[model samples]
Target: MKTKFNTSKFLAIVFIAGAITLSSCSNDDEDNNVVPELEVKTVEDLDGSQGPVFFSLSTGTAVQESATTWDIKFNSSNFSFGNGAEGQVIEGIFENYVVAPASGYSADDLAGIGSLYTYTGQAASGAQHAVLPTPGRILVVKTHDNKYAKIELISYYVGNPDTNSEAFINLETRPQSRVYTFNYVVQPDGSTNLK
Candidate 1:
């Protein structure tokens, strides 16, 4: 006896298989497009003027400068990276940055963080003599562990006081300096994708 090919059953099986394959492909596409969340933090009252404060981008915490795990150190707006760490500065809106550059990172140099802010003098005509974060300056760091991070310096005051406010304009009432309020994103997979 010859076996019959059940056309309806064969079509059903083919349709189901195709659906499963498409579902899997769709899931993979979603995963590939997923972006890591951004981490925002403020290192308040660090008083980098008194000493250098170490920070770890990988852990999103301030580590002791002497600790070998630290990735960068902050000293009065002067940022220096740890061993084998490097960084680059780019001019653009922080939210627009997706992928960090793979090269052109300065090693243990001030070239990256040097242009982060502008200090207006007491004798300046208009705005208060405060250390203001440059409008579009962003820092991208290749961490000591070889991971990637993007930093946006938001404020240099304790509470991130409004620079235009009269309170901040007054020297006596000016928010304490050297307090870093910034947003950053670190790529945990050690890839250049900083989004």
Candidate 2:
């Protein structure tokens, strides 16, 4: 007896082949030039806090202002705070360091330093606490009257856990040594200012 062909099996094979063909054809239409969207979330610190506050400086301008966030464009990598004694000192550098204007000043201008300043009080009622330790001391050595100058933190130590933490800020300079003090300022945004 002649067996009836299994139509369903044939149809299944045809369907499978058609699906593979369509999939291969459609894949080529995908544009490789299309960039995938990246979702970046801000990570909080270990203390359930946000990152440190940042400030931006105006190039060739003496005036500076506080910023909620810093953009790469107006700020230089050289303008940074050095790690404290606990942290390793950068190679070929001293532990305590400061920045001065590259030009338009004499050796005296460079010689005269200012105190580094930082905040040291409890968080104000409406102020946000900083994740990083604020500077509590400064040593400034300014010899001449204010003509033109530029300065920024290169690195510093935040006090140890056993001791109270402190940050430095330049206040003024004396003849023998730089007279720096640790002082804090309440900013308009209710954040502490550490110069």
Candidate 1 worst ten-residue window by lDDT: 40-49
lDDT of 1 by residue, 1-195 (tens): 999999999999999999999999999999999875755554545455456778888777878877777887877877888978888788888888888998999875573234988887674564566888888889899989999888888888788888888788888888778878788888888887766
lDDT of 2 by residue, 2-103 (tens): 999999999999999999999887776666545343221121211101223222221221222343222111121112221110011111211233232223
Looking at model 1, residue 128 earns an lDDT score of 60
Runs off by more than 4 Å, candidate 2 = 1-4, 31-33, 36-195
User: Which residue ranges in model 1 land beyond 4 Å of their true spot?
Assistant: 1-49, 111-114, 122-126
TM-score of 1: 0.81
The backbone clash count of each candidate, in order, is: 0, 41
Superposition error at 65 for model 1 (Å): 1.8
